[model samples]
Target: MKELVEVLAKALVDHPEEVRVNEVVKDRSIVYELSVAPEDMGKIIGKQGRIAKALRTVVNSAAAKEKKRVTIEIL
Candidate 1:
């Protein structure tokens, strides 16, 4: 999960090396916190948060295959 977020974020950011993903696991859900260079934040988020929503949708779909609940937070 972390790797997925990292790869996706790196692909969207200008400073790919600065992309970071942190995972927090709970009993029923997983939280992925993503971070990127300040300059690349907007690129990852996209206009009006469309990109972020799409990313979250993809993550959720993947998690669904494993019967797991996952959430993505960009910070």
Candidate 2:
């Protein structure tokens, strides 16, 4: 799951080396925090957050098979 977010974010950013994904497991859910270069924030977010929404949707769908709630936060 972490790898998925990393790959997506890295592909969208100019500074691939600066892309990072942190996973935090709570009692009932998993949180993925995606961090990218400040200058590349817009690319990750996209127009009116469309890109971010799509990214989260993809992650959530992939995690559905595991029966766990997953969330992605872009930082």
Candidate 3:
């Protein structure tokens, strides 16, 4: 799960090397915190948060099979 977020971030940001993903496991749910270069924030989040919404959707669906809730936070 961490890897997936990392890959997605790297692809979206110009500073690929600065992309970072931290995972926090809480009970049956997984939380992912993604940090990218400040200048690349707009690209990752997109206009009106459309990209952010899509990202969360993808992660949630992927974790559905495991019956776990997934949350993504961009920082």
Candidate 4:
């Protein structure tokens, strides 16, 4: 899950090397915290947060395959 966020974030950001994803797993859900260079935040988020929404949707779909719930937080 962390890898997924990292890969997507890297691809979206100007400073790919600065992309970082941290994951926390609980009993029923997983939380992925994504961080990128300040300058690239807008790019990752996109207009009206559409890109972020899409990214979350992708993560949710992937997690559903395993019967898990996951949330993505861009910080």
Best by TM-score: 2
Error of 2 at 18 (Å): 0.2
**Number of the top candidate by lDDT?**
2
Using Cα atoms with residue i matched to residue i, what is each candidate's TM-score against the true structure?
A: 0.95, 0.96, 0.93, 0.94
Q: List the residue pairs that clash in candidate 1.
A: none
Clashes of each: 0, 0, 0, 0
On residues 1-75, what C-alpha lDDT tens digit does candidate 2 reach at each position? 899889988888899999989999999999998889899999999999999999999999999988889999887
Candidate 1's TM-score = 0.95
**Model 1: residues with Cα > 4 Å off, grouped in runs:** none
Give lDDT per model, in order: 0.90, 0.92, 0.89, 0.90
Give per-residue CA lDDT, model 3, range 5-73, as digits (tens): 888878888999999899999987889999998899999999999999998998888888778899999
Kindly list the per-residue Cα lDDT of model 4 for residues 19-64, writing each as its tens digit. 9888888888999989899999999899999999999999899989
Greater-lDDT candidate between 2 and 4: 2
lDDT of 3: 0.89
* Pairs of residues clashing in candidate 4: none
lDDT string for model 1 (1-73, tens) is 7788788888887899998888999888999999899999899999999999999999998888989999998
For model 4, the superposed segments whose C-alpha errors exceed 4 Å read none
Runs in model 3 deviating more than 4 A are none
lDDT of 3 at 60: 88
lDDT for residue 42 in candidate 3, whole number 0-100:
96
